[model samples]
Target: MDNASLKKRDLAVLWHPCSQMKDYERYPMTPIKRGEGVYLEDFDGNRYIDAVSSWWVNLFGHSNPIIANAMKEQVDKLEHVIFAGFTHEPAIDLAEQLVAMTPEGLDRVFYGENGSSAVEIALKMSLHYWQLAGKPEKTQFIALESGYHGETTGALAVSDLGLYKAPYKPLMFDVMTAPSPDCFYREEGESWHDYSLRQFEKMRELVEREHKKVAAIIVEPLVQCASGMRMYHPVYLSELRKLCDEFDVHLIADEIAVGFGRTGTLFACEQADISPDFMCVSKGLTAGFLPLSAMLTRESIFQAFYDDYEKLTAFLHSHSYTGYATGCAVAKATLDIFQSQPVIENNKVLAQHMAQATAHFADHPNIAEVRQTGMILAAEMVQDKKSRTPYNWKERRGMRVYEHALSQGALLRPLGNIVYFMPPYVITPEEIDKLADIAWQGIQLATKD
Candidate 1:
């Protein structure tokens, strides 16, 4: 019932994701009892703002009444059924909406339980499509350096982040890596557009050489979230799309983190005026209400798998909870909220407030860069600002900031040395100021010797 008791029980039985279990001995887990509109209440009745949107999944807010009511109504009627042949109205309706909302040419929808599974489904589908088209040699994939797709074997194989994929390298299939278009790596006095265009040469060279063996190229669209919130220009996507078309390679846009108006646009690919072959979406699909993910693809790719069972060309990938009625209903409600309210327009104002609130960090001596991409903003902490020398990862500087922010009643989880804020759409401008103030204090505490 209380924080201490719950911590003891949880530590005894639970293994948390992306955490070193022994660290819990020093920093106890936060026992959240309930959440409401950008705030999570702990068992002790202390409230902390959900600055990261509960791992960037939440959209409208935590415990949103609209989504909750839809879930309740759907569960009352029908909770779930096997998705093999028994289809329901909610599932069918949600799929239709997703196909319509996404960019043109994405006419088919495939269901999965999570983002990683969605990426795996796309990867398998691309390879299988090539096999059925008499090009079995097109078996390889290309990913951006430091890009993260997911943790599954197929997803990890396409990802280039060593932190998650190093230990499992032997288990993963080989993948080619292209230099990231992250603007952080751009030279002095260079524009993001120019640098991104320059970076595309590496990808062009790689794809041109290996197009015959490459099945697809997977990217995280505008912002590479898992890679410390590193971002790039929209022009990169436009050029990448052209290159893929020239080389007959499929472009898979992993919009799991940057989709659903997080990148200022409904979809990041829209800013580039391009449509990817496979669009993997999740996280905010159900507004953090349930586990649901979808892979939207073009009709051309879908047709490659539409063959007789005797030919063994049918795609057999599936999840037991694929297209759950409750999840589908919640997703429909989430979309309804988008339609009813000016979510994207409101976010534009909120994003301006965020930019103004954190602008002071740009002058801080220990802060290298203060970057903003729509609702997501990050301030990279460095040991020296001029040289941009990063603090040793072993020092755990980001953890110090996290602990400080927790004491100040805010949940500003840093991605390594990069402190960031990705608040829900329901957050007000005043709330943005509060989080900015807390983050500033945390940064000072973490930077002090």
Candidate 2:
């Protein structure tokens, strides 16, 4: 179909995520035809660099041949099978590799179809684990203010972001929120390290008060994606880990966005030197080739539900495509690429280059803050630097910068006034320069006109 015709059809028949349909009049969606190595080509053949990793996936860039070949081989052999009654080599092997790569003590894997599903699974697993261990009163979870888990009802219950969960509160379960790792908005003159410790202190107090009812405390580790990429010091997470152990609360690390080298480490939790009781991982797990998530847990937690069939005490949750052969094969191959290629080391170099380039804008008149960890970076805009006052979200400064970047052939989707980058690991030092140049240009266009 012609591009115009397709656009008209889409406008008539589809609803998109995080978009105001009325705003489509001024900002139309680009019809992309092809993508490769961190770039997208439109239907009319205009090119744009994928600076956000196509929503922070596409780890090896679009369609790496190794993963693609693995999927091809798997589909030709056995596409999918019922995961409950059957098991496969790819799933078992991938799980084994994941267990080996992850921090110590996490030995069981539960596959779910999406990030939200994985989150729900983790929450349910944690809650059920406690129930199986004879603590049925522990059902509530401790999440962070401005934290985002996902859109599912269970996941939404733990998330406090109004943009995603506000209207659904009537149907959601109970959750208590603590201060996030948003150091940028912390009290003036207080160091981030101090701020982090205080936040953890409050969380510790809350868990102490509600230990009987709280099942788990969930976090995004180094990068809080939906809350504007808020970063934190490792000391805070280490203390949080200790508190969880002290209070006997399960720690769930939602590594959906920060896993697989995004944070310059294989997993962001690694940097903190803390192993959570459960981890929700997806997004880049299959290198953006497919939708799959795995909620990994310690063997102790898994063992709680290891009873005979009649008890129904067994954690009974299953998805039909739980161990889809193709996804498992692709995930396996993707993990192989991480070892055969210098993905993590290469990202360390890229992160350093990004830091140097982004540092130039730290003093820009419109820039309020530049926060980064590894390849992940955020540029927060504000009206008053001294006060750290953010522009009114209603004014849409972030949206403006985003549109300008799109017009200039670079995709940098901003979260509120925070324009950030989470580029593919394959990006070279030269491309890093290209991204910074375009980002600065977009900033100028956003502010000037």
Cα lDDT of model 2 by residue, 1-449, tens digit: 55577788889999988889988887888878888888888877778888898888789888678888899999999999999878999999999999999989889999999899999999999999888888899988999888888989999899878878878889998889888867876787888888888778888788889988889999888778888888887777899899999988999999999999888889999988999999999999999999899999998888788888998887778888898778999999999998798888888888999998878888888888899988899988887778778787888878787787777788988888888989888888887787788788777666553
Model 1 earns a TM-score of 0.99
- Output the number of the lDDT-best candidate: 1
Q: Write the per-residue lDDT of candidate 1 for residues 130-156, one digit (tens) a residue.
A: 998899999999999999999899999
Global lDDT of model 2: 0.87
Q: Candidate 1: deviation at residue 282, Å? A: 0.6
Colliding residue pairs in candidate 2: none
Off by over 4 Å in 1: none
Deviating ranges (above 4 Å) for candidate 2: 187-189
**Which pairs in model 1 have colliding backbones?**
none
What is the C-alpha local distance difference test score of candidate 1? 0.94
Q: What are the Cα lDDT values of the candidates? A: 0.94, 0.87
Model 2, TM vs. native: 0.97
